[model samples]
Target: MTTLHQEHTAHDHEHGPACGHTPVPHGDHVDYAHDGHLHRAHAGHYDECEQGGHVAHDGHGHAHGRDCGHDSVPHGDHVDYLHDGHRHAAHDGHWDDH
Candidate 1:
């Protein structure tokens, strides 16, 4: 017998710690394009190998993630942010809360 896996993506960046969900942290998430926008996922919600944040999927099931999307470095980019001061670039790559 064979099985098929379907992935559903959605945009949800407005969610913050204020919503009672812990911020998953940077570099521990993936942003997928959805509905003309990008949606981020936490390690606890996806198959993250590098970090032990993998979520087990029982045959067919969905999981809700908390605390994610803190890392902003591109896949091939070697960029590091500072603690103090902010880097203002055109479209810093973060989802604008507009």
Candidate 2:
């Protein structure tokens, strides 16, 4: 005698503003939050990923580290810094299993 088993998996294809390939949910020129994320703010401005979303200005800074005073995006294990018209990425010498 023999037995058989089957398995199945599901995947989600949702995309966000960062994807840069999809249109904004409202289908108009929405305000990109000062932090880099887009959310509902003005009729043509989107809100932030959190709250009080503002237009994504050229020098507002990172979305995650906006309150931290850093002008770059943090990519998990490392931090990216942008200043003086230059950009750099550095690791804090720490790693996690996650």
What is the clash tally of candidate 2? 8
Error of 2 at 63 (Å): 21
Q: Write the per-residue lDDT of candidate 2 for residues 12-83, one digit (tens) a residue.
A: 222346744323233233322232332333333233322222222344333434464535444334544443
- Per-model TM-score on C-alpha atoms: 0.19, 0.21
lDDT (Cα atoms) of all candidates against the true structure: 0.27, 0.32
RMSD of 1: 17.9
> In candidate 2, how many Å is residue 79 off?
1.0
lDDT (Cα, tens digit) per residue for candidate 1, span 1-98: 11112223332344444643233333433333223222344432322112122232223221212333233322222222211121111123331111
lDDT of 2 at 75: 35
lDDT of 1 at 22: 31
The candidate that achieves the highest TM-score relative to the unseen native structure: 2
